[model samples]
Target: MVWFLQAAAAPALMALAAGAAISALAIRLCAAPVETAASAAAVLVGTDEHELDADDPGNLGGPHLRSARMVRHGAALSADLVALSTAGAAVGLLLGVPVLAAEGIITVLLALGVAMLAAAAAAVVPHRGRPGLERAALQLGGIIPAVLGGAAAVAAAALWIPSRYKDLRFEDVGLENFTDPAITGGTPTPRTELEPMIEQALTDMGQWVSQTDESQYASAFLDVLTLYSVTPNVVVAIALGLGVLSALALAQLLGGAGHRFGGSVLRAARTSRTGGALGITAGLGSTALLAAGGIALLVLVTAVLNVLAAGVPSLALALLAHAGLGALIVAAACAGPLLAPVLADRPEAAVGLRNAAAAAATGPRGVMLLSGLLTALAALGPVVSALQLAPRAATIWEDRSLHALTPSALPLLGGIALGVLTVLLVTSAVLDGARRLGANAVVETRASLLEGRGRAELGELAEMVRRAAAPALVVAVLAPIVAGFGLGPAALPGLMIGVALTAAGLGLWMIGAASTLENAAAVIGSGRYGGRGSWGHSGALGGAVLTGTLRAAIGAVALPLLLTTSLVSALAVSAVVGLSTDGTSHFLRWGVAALAIIVALTCWVIAATAPEVDLEDGEAELSTPLFARADDAPADTLAAMDWEVGDEDVERTPARARGKRRRGAADDDGRAPEDAKD
Candidate 1:
């Protein structure tokens, strides 16, 4: 009854303690800022006044008159408020010593550590290149280092403290009394008495099983157990490792293939294919690494959980979930490369790969079907067990100790997650770089086969591709990290959705590029061969057509992949755990929403680009400012203009008739014959 009462009172006591802490901190926070503001105001206005300026509006210098002065005062108050709030929490804990002086020090250190963690938590939001983001970043930067320092100090204290009770019998100095070479047959004494030794052993074992406290011995034990689990589960370990490697390879294959396809389309286009190859290569490598890392991590984490659960039906279900997550992760990883060709206006390459994949998937559809069915059956083990004749079997399979078993799995899981993050970040950085390169290429000059002007355009294109790739890669990687850090698992689905969108965008870019290249080549060739009448259409229109097609295909593939993949599924699961909601329903809602958005965006983009044809042409037209303005000007001025319009300026005449007409006109006749008209 006493214990129960104590337990019941504990919750209320804790709540009261927490409330007191907050109240004390708030008081300090409020007081410091008020004092600071008052001092600043006195210094600025030469008097203490709550208002900024005196009654005169024109006199800005007065305490009661100037808005700027008031603003400064406000700023000071805000800064002081923050500093005091943080510092108060630190000081309050120091003042309130719950235990002995030594324990109090420990408590204060722990409080400081908490403060540091809180600061870091506040900084997880993205602040890069955004309005006010820099300020946030800078503030976070300052806070994190301080927090880290505090954490280090706390950790040192924690490490120095005694891990286990020194009162244990084995620690007694009297154990040394048992030392005797002759009686013990030269064996050294254990130092502890016989009865104490037995008691201590049992106590140690109890501690080990219970994981009662953090200690050097406990940590070492856990580490050894983890290592043992990893070593013995060789099959699972190998599978996990291979999963990562294979995912990487697959991503690379997709990226490379996409890159190649883009290059091919660009080559057919007859435009400069400067960074296309590099983009393809980087894209492929990045994709592969990310995909493999994600897969390896999913497999490792799920496997650990499954084994920990003692092969309960839940394990199979978890594995199935993990497999789905792996697929999504790989899909997300490959998106950039897969969409690369399309973005480059390389429809042929994109189409070829797309067709090939679809055909392959469909060709062995039965195998896929059988495999899926078997997997489903395996996953249903838990449900089947619930309906089984042997209830004892289920009970026998109940989860045992997590301590010994989870160690191995945790490391593998952490490594996998880290690996995936590394790959994604690297890939995103590369892509972002490429994107910037491509954008810059618009102005970049190169050694061209055509005129100086044409060379400039090609150079621009090359530079654009090069610059853009890095940024694209950066964006790709950043998304994953931001998702993981800021929103935990919920952020993952966002990435999948974002990747899908990006893939679609890239695809359109490729298609448009291919069309433009083809048109340019045709135009140049026609101009050289005097085939203007036969072929004089603008390249921009064709490019637009290609871009539309590319974008469409990307959207088609991306939407499904994003909706169905494991990466998003994992995120959904995480959301469920963190938010305590139904993951399946949440994911379904998200997928449906994404699909709708994709459909809407596709329609909107297609409609917008359809009439204009080549979206890039408008930009090209803008680039040729003088030429465009001239074309738009009066026809008379255009005719009189000295600027060359290529062969378009030339007069037309039949081959044989022109000479005969000239010769007849030259003959000494007052009036030229009907056939000799000039």
Candidate 2:
């Protein structure tokens, strides 16, 4: 009850905080971190600081005492997307260039330059090619996975296309309808209305799903890959462009979800075992709820979309399609936790799980927006080919999609994404804010009073609770790996989800405790430096500005990559998946994908070396800037105060709390110390 009461104070503070009243706009934009901070504070107020010791993990530092910048946390995270793209782009070009060479469209100079770029992208993983040629060779092995998958996709396409898409020849379809009438007589009548056409297509699709073997889905996917790949240099160009766009979506995922995950896991480690366990349980429940709620939210908005779709059917169709994809992502994310047992002990489960998240995040909104712009240009190749070149015996398969699922749907989704974006900007912003608020209030208030302690026990209790949670963390991580070993090749996709959930769950457990600490410190800090004339407030504001700008700068980098690498993996992965027929080669195909993910991530890790700095100030330089200096950090990672504070400001904070903040704080270096007594 008290927790909710404290959480209720957040909006009031937002409204009452000195300059907070100045802008609702600012509140909306920055609500994510602010809400997170506030929620963290309320938990501490309700906490029992007993049954723990200083050696506990939750005693580790949090972002609260020193202001955490959204930028410093996730600035370089987009490197993951870039790495995927270059590896993919290399594979695509290597596979496609030969076709061009056969056609005599390729030049020596062009091939060399393309090769160099790909090599460089591959080499830059983790950092300088320090992993040596052997590692590079391993990364080069990444191409094997995609190639293996692509070959399988092609084989799959061959068997399925003729059986099902054998006859897509419509009288009114293609360049034949748009060409000069003199050659093909007058325009045909009885044109189909798009709504009915789409309806019929969807109806057929439903029927297909009900009756067809599941393997046909991959066969169906391969159909799209064929068109893109047959285009010579165009495929490479298109892939590079998509890879660029994918970087943005990836960055956001790492910053938003990954950051959340990392923080949660770290905090869980810092909390009491029982509290962490309960926190984990609650988090899983929330994840399920959020996913369900997101779908329900989308479903509710669908009526509004329906009205719009009635007026502009194409636009609505795209939104509807993107909505379906979004629903799937949410479903997958939520369900993955339930399936965590399947992911344990995989060779590179973490890498695969991260892939799933990145794939989901980029596919719906990001892909739709970027690909929509290129729709006109993308259409030109097919239009020109269909009109100029005489249709080959097998050309219909190349030029046209089997059904409504192909080009039109992708472009429509993209268009809809762009169109509805501005309107939904506020929607997303409000959502982030609301989520932040709801998460803290519920968790903290309910779990605040686990066990009570004495007046003299204030500081001791907080430390105890934090440490208690530490030991249980090992079980959380290892359980999945152990469970996963009992599984097989089929676990590939599930592994991705499980990894995601494990990360989410671990992080989820820490939320209440971390939030309690950070929010409390923030509250105390706010009051201490609440004055408009205070240096602390001014410093915080400056840090906020710097971080906001830095984040924007990172976004700027992603914008161009959005153009190139967004499709890089899609092209590469699809091409690979298309090579194998569905089901028959399921193990082989997914195994290839797993290998690719492992190879790419492995190269990035093993090849990249982090050099330690012996200098004292190096810790500060290495640490996230704009955050509080280690010297100023509270005894507890989140704050110096116990659950209780006094009427006198000085009494609330213990001088002993600042005596030692680990060797890292005292000596300014955690990574390098002779005695290594942290």
Candidate 3:
């Protein structure tokens, strides 16, 4: 519940996210043919179509070819994102917006993770593999960029071309001298997208010395940051990142099938391929890591772990939503690389492996588009509000919005809710089982490429696949449970209408449960209580909460109890218990909201006072001089004197001399020069 509250978390989150995002991108792009062929024999072409060894995992050639192919896709997604973030970082120097620098990197990666989870969820419902709504989404996505770019280009040309030619003569045109605004510092800039982010990052880094706290490296760190911000490192790195990402995205999406050289790899046998299964495994790994991050972020922001205690199911649902979106964006980018593979080596097709590898994203240039879409859809406003697209997006950020959602407090009788949630979890599992029923059902008649592999090897391979897919699958399914607790009540009803997802549950169940058990054991095994003061009050509160939690757990698993009474009757008892306890005394004094505010303020104050940020001021000076004259600026340049300077030179404001009037002994008026001047 309190992870994002820490400073300096953005970069680490992004680094891991980028690594994970590319895994899916690699599989979707370069090794998709193997995946498709493994799924259904009909997807292959010519000789390869009939040669399909559906379960082999060897059809994409071998480990070498598969891996080699994935390199392009992996590089495209990672490098592009890095470049974009770097550019944002650099541009942030100008606008004082630090978050912009890395915002694309984190949000986009998470968004892709989210998208994939969505696809997994959709898989829950049965479908023929025909394009439906996605076709429109693709068309809309494709058209918007083209139209916007064309419109912008035309406007720029119309505004600039006539003016250039208006003053043109053949002689003048040939010898044009350009004015450099760089020297004069009149350069305009984008909005302050990066300032706050960078400042926050800087503050977090320098926080040790901000208050009474001390660290030996604190001063040194500030000095290094000063050097970094003051120099062109930020600018150079950012510009390089932006330009490179832009070029790569364009080249990959627009690259021709024919090589710059006349030669091609199209006729190369599929045996030349490399390890394709690894990409899927990588995709799985990346998905899980991303889910963890998304879950952590939500837990911190939503106060799920607050003393008030939110509906646990709600937290689970939100995390899943994030995972689903992130997966989808990543999946879309993967489409470019995978499309040709899906086509296979058909006679009519000339597409090759190399052509599919260089693909990457989703907005301004497809950054976080899914998040925007989700927020727009989930906003608790009217249809008229939806239609008014650009009318003050403040509503989109309101507390009511999912982006700012505050989970409903966990009811005292929430044990029944857990049981209900468990039932929903069972249902989601059933749906997912149905989803896997038809995936790649046709195994080829040929001896399995993996036939000689031992039982252990097959089991290991199956385990890898399962582990890889588990994060996304688990998130998707658990998210359905949250929906039952009244999260998102959109189109789907009686199933997945809302989400109550919390990634904390997954980690706790999978990883933290053992430690939790260990703690309980140690507590139970202790000879006697010694830490508490003379009075037992200190431990008593935690004890009550712990024992109460145990009771609730017992109630949750007691199916006979549920059977003995109707659901309504059971619910009534739970409600009675909750109402009875609602007004009773408890440990909370300031409450969770107050604590959250205090923590936020402390973090902000810490960041606001961070050292080594003065270097940014210097960088600003180098980028743009205030663009207005300061009172103390040097008087006008001597070289470009006005034609009417004789009159203009007469002090315009005589009462306020440019220089302080001199009063000294050197003045000779008559008697004693010093006395006369005085």
- How does candidate 3 fare on TM-score? 0.23
**TM-score of every candidate:** 0.23, 0.25, 0.23
Q: With candidate 3 superimposed using the best TM-score fit, by how many Å does residue 186's alpha carbon deviate from the native?
A: 50
The backbone clash count of each candidate, in order, is 78, 56, 60
Over 1-678, each residue of candidate 1 has an lDDT whose tens digit, in order, gives: 112332123223323333332333222222222222222222122111112222332212222113322422244223322332222222222221211123323333343344444335434533222442432332233334333433343344345433332222322213333343422345665533433543445444545447634533344333322322221222222222222233334333232222322443334323322222332333233333433443344346456545643343333343332222222222222222222222332224333333222211110111111112122222222222222211121121121101112334332234234434433433343333323332332123111111233222222322332232333222322333333333333234334434433332332233233333333333333342222221212232223222322222221122222222212222233332333122234345345445544543443343223221122444554445412322355356766777553454334656576667567666856565554464
Every candidate's lDDT: 0.30, 0.27, 0.27
Which candidate leads in TM-score? 2
lDDT for residue 129 in candidate 3, whole number 0-100 = 21
> How well does candidate 2 match the true structure in TM-score terms?
0.25
The superposed Cα distance between candidate 1 and the true structure at residue 68, in angstroms, equals: 55
What's the ranking of the predictions by TM-score, best on top? 2, 3, 1
lDDT of 2 by residue, 20-90 (tens): 11121122223333333332332222222221211222321122212223221222222322332222222
Model 3, which residues run further than 4 Å from truth? 1-283, 286-348, 351-408, 411-436, 439-678
Q: What is the lDDT of residue 45 in candidate 1?
A: 24
Candidate 3 per-residue lDDT over residues 1-678, each given as its tens digit? 013422244334323332333333222222222222222222221113233222244353233223323442354334434332322221112121121222222323333333343334333432212233332233233333333322332233234222221122212212122222321133432223323444555556545236423222343334323322332222222222222233223222222111111111111111112222322222223324433443344344334222111222222222222222322233333333223333332334332321221121211112222222122111112111121221222233221221212234232123234434533442233223212221221222122322442211111223222322333223322322232222221111212112223112232122211112212212222222222121121222122222222211221111111111111121122222232234422223124224434543453344333221121334544412322222446567878765464546655737455333332333333445445545
lDDT of 2 at 423: 20
